[model samples]
Target: MEMENMIGLTDLLAAAIRAWKQICVTMLVFALLLGGYQGYRQYKLATDPENSPEKIEERYQAALEDYEKRGEELQKKLEGQEESLASKEEYREESLLIKIDPYNKYITNIVFSFSNIDESAQLFRYPNTAADYLPKKIRSQYLELWKSMDVPRDLADGRYADLEWKYLNELISIPALEGELLSIRTMGASAKDAEDLAGAIFAYFDGHRDAIGRSSAAHELSILNQSTKYVIDEELKTKQESLDKEIEDLKTGIEDTKQSIEDLTEPEREDGYSVTAIVKSVAKYVALGAAGGLFLACFLVCCWWIFADRAANSFQLERSVGAPFLGAMKPSCPPAERLAAAVMGERRWRDPEQASAYIREQAEAGFPKEGKVLLLSTLPEGKAGAGMAGLASALEGYAVTSVLDALHDPKAVKAIQDCAAAVFVEMAGQSRLTDIRDLAAQVEGAKRPVLGVIAI
Candidate 1:
């Protein structure tokens, strides 16, 4: 099946090569028509003032400069806001007051410290394995924070979880105390949430103090007994209200500055391709048209060549008609010489010197060796008449009967009956296969042996 398909494709390619000129002309004409339509569209766009390339580029450049200027102003304003928030008298006073507030402590920075945590670690193992050995519930709660932040749950290396652990480590520090201690701290958006999260973390350690390892139990108990660390100051809580109000006002000012920047920088987009871009795109297509036109022309020409009916060579002619190729005449042979050869009944023979000799040799091979012989030509009118005359002249030794119109003549069989043998002459590529077949059938019906085909 594959071989057959390949052969068919090969034939199609051959046909296309034969008709390449016609195919190329046709393709170029179609490409020009298509290019004209596209050019028309480009003309309309180029003429439109609002959408033209120059206008769009000018507007874009203006917008870009404005954005850059506003961006610098926005950065300065934000820096000023940050400085105000850090340096204001109220801000300092509030931070100090927050240090002592019972409720403020819950939402403020909490610190956890681990002493002798890495004392027993191996060189190849993580220095802080205590974080990994946490109770299942505590570990799950810690992992939940990362999951809420959209970290993938199936990460085997737990890369994001490790990052979160690093963040927890940053919130902790160990003092060079004389004993082992584990401190855990947590903070949230409000006093209540922070208090709850911190308390939960602290409770996990408090409840698991005995599990800290027997070697550190005594030190752990000492750290847990520091109850005065939770004491609160009532005066700072009272002052926290005013400080909160001042902070809120500063935040509002910063937000207003941000909004102004956003308003200045918001993008102003223009629809559709820019005029320059459109022109470039059209040029690209025109180039593609030239390339595609060439390719299509070649392909179509190959198809025409493959499917062409005319015999391309003597070998092809012999194979197509299932005949022995006796001889052939060159297409470059002059028309006058061809006509002269036809007039002397010698069109079937290639060499002029051999014509008379071939005639004398074949004269006695068929019936009525000494009588009239029929010379027939498959070509039309002038060509056939010239050939018949030539053959009659060639067979001067015998009484030769010429029949140029024998192919369609009703009495052609009767004319043939009067002759001993018949000759069929034809041009190789010019004659139709069907016409040749019809002529052969006619000669067979007359019961005359076809001497042979003459390829001219």
Candidate 2:
């Protein structure tokens, strides 16, 4: 029973195997179509400048050169000043102060007025008070009093005398003090004495002259420095503008060149030939289109094979156990065999008993009873043999018995041959079995009269 079931299954799988070529060819066709589509897409993308590595590299180089040139020009324009003003630490400190109170009037006013002021001068006159001349401990009290204006330092005795003579001289030299000093000199002081006093005052003022000169010189130098920066900045701006224009022109030219290349060497259409005849001529020898066609054809053949395989498997399962087999067919083979079978009413027999009776009648009509011992056989694992055996057993006056346990016992074939009219049933329809024609010859050539044979 297990053997019969396995034989049925094997017959089914063998039919499917016979159709494997068609299935493989179909799959190959689909694979080729997919591969062709991908190849065409790649070709189109490559023809465009944006996707071409060489073109991309060329554009990148041009951009890099432009950037480098701009950097060099900027460096030359702001040579010395860049080092001083471009320090990160200076910018960070300035940014911190700005963040504290962006609209604080005192800070805004001071920074705006004195951003260019000498650092030393700013430190010395930050408070701008007389307390700056006093000792630190005493200066604090003086500063407190000054803020309150409780005791005016100008009205106090010895305040005028204690004033630094250099500071006092600076006050005296003011244009507003000229007339008052002249009146004081005329009021009873001698010319010589007045002159000496004025001279002493001038000397006192001269002692503090270093601070004024340094402040004035620094301011003038800052102005000169800014004027120079303005001139260089303008020159650099003009150069940058010129370079920008040139770069634009070059980019336009590059784009035009790329467009021309695309127009001249565009990708081909689905027919596997380029639009440009010149390109096609050069590339025709590569046989790219032929290769693609071959792949598509094979794929289609594989699909047909798979479809046929499924049909064959279904046929095996649905077929009745007593049905007679038509001859095996292949798409590539000649149709003569099928035509012959059809004309003889042997294409397929639905009733195995009718087929067996027909065979027996034909044999008895032609040959003697001594020649009726027909040894019918099939390929190993073939259902055709079992069907034949069943038909043979149903024959009149013939005691038919099937012995199929030979798979385990090699000598079983000899043991079963003792019967007067024996039909040795060999399996069939498996891919690895011996050739049908070869097995037929071997069985029929035996001394027994082999009447008829069938393949699953």
Candidate 3:
């Protein structure tokens, strides 16, 4: 007899073997469906306009053109940057204080004072009212001589050749004649140059001394102070530092842009084709589908086996119906060739005579033996197989009465009341275990003791 819970490993294995055809068919169906879908997808991809060779080539050409255009723009940008950087470098060297001698600078101060013919070297002209007029009259002529001296231009090829405009501007200056005295200052590359610039100023004045006298005869020429002092150009030095920092920042930006242009990459394109990968992919999907279908089929079979509630064997039947098991019909399988019978399947059958004998034996103990025995079943009259009739015929001497679906039959109620005892008859795989249980309850509830269950 089959025994244990529905999911017991050994029993489940046996059930799977019995239902192997269903599992195989499910797997085959799933594999074919998945493989067909994969092939269809591959064919669709191959036929798509977007994937056509001409379309792909057109896209490649567009991409290549864009790439070349980007490269050209980058090159132009780099050229512009380099040009700007070079021009800035030249300007920074020439205009910024980088070319100025901050540490080795020399300054000279020249002060010219005016005097009346009667006042001898007066710090302030007596009353000071004539002081402004005298200085202004002479200094204006003095400045004109200084600016038009051409001293710097004459020295430009010699000692001042390396000096930029910022430095050259410091080397000479034009003073206003709005003060008490006239003071002009000049910066020089060295102490010697400072003294020499002061001398050049004096020499130019000496040559233009007649012109100076002709312009300001009302004012007298006074002592000139040519005092040379050593000092640094701090403001120019600060500007030079600032310009250096800007040049460094520009250099960094150029380098970064250059690196970015270098790092630019061309778009990627799929280059080759192969059926090997496609075949492998299809195989993988088919295998996975088959495995899934196999598991699903097994699960369905297991659910039907467990919950369909069809009593499997004598042990299972007795427990479900709560009645003693007698026996089942013999040779229930249909005819088959010997080879098929041996190789494919078989059904277990119990002797029907044994079941009949048990019912008789139950009646002999406590009930009348000659009375009719109710042969009760839960199947409809038509589907309740000939096995019930055959069992009834097998009990030759007993007065037997057969009823189908006894729970629903009014005649079964009367027969069950008159009969000496009742025997439950059901076929495995066709009769439900729950029906047998309910029927057994109904019989016991009617106070007609159930003799036993007979499974065919």
Whole-model alpha-carbon lDDT for candidate 1: 0.52
Q: For model 1, where is the 10-residue window of minimal lDDT?
A: 1-10
Please give the lDDT score at residue 4 for candidate 1.
12
Q: Give the deviation of candidate 2 from the true structure as CA RMSD.
A: 23.0
Count residue pairs with overlapping backbones in model 3: 0
Looking at model 3, the pairs that clash are none
Please give the TM-score that candidate 3 achieves against the real structure: 0.42
Error of 2 at 169 (Å): 99
C-alpha lDDT values of all predictions:
0.52, 0.36, 0.67
| Model 2 Cα lDDT, one tens digit per residue, 1-456 | 222222333333343344455545655565556556655665675576664556666666776776666656545544433443344334334322212222221100000011232344435654666532322222233223323432213323333444443333321222212111111110001333223433333333334334444533222111111000011134434544554565455555555544544444322222232346324443442345445555565445445434332222212321311223323212222354334333323335445556566655644553345423433343332434444545455455544444333333354345335434434333222312223333333333443333333332
Which candidate order results from sorting by TM-score in descending order? 3, 1, 2
The clash count of every prediction, one per candidate, is 28, 23, 0
lDDT (10s digit) by residue, model 1, range 75-121: 89888987887666544453323444445443333333343333343
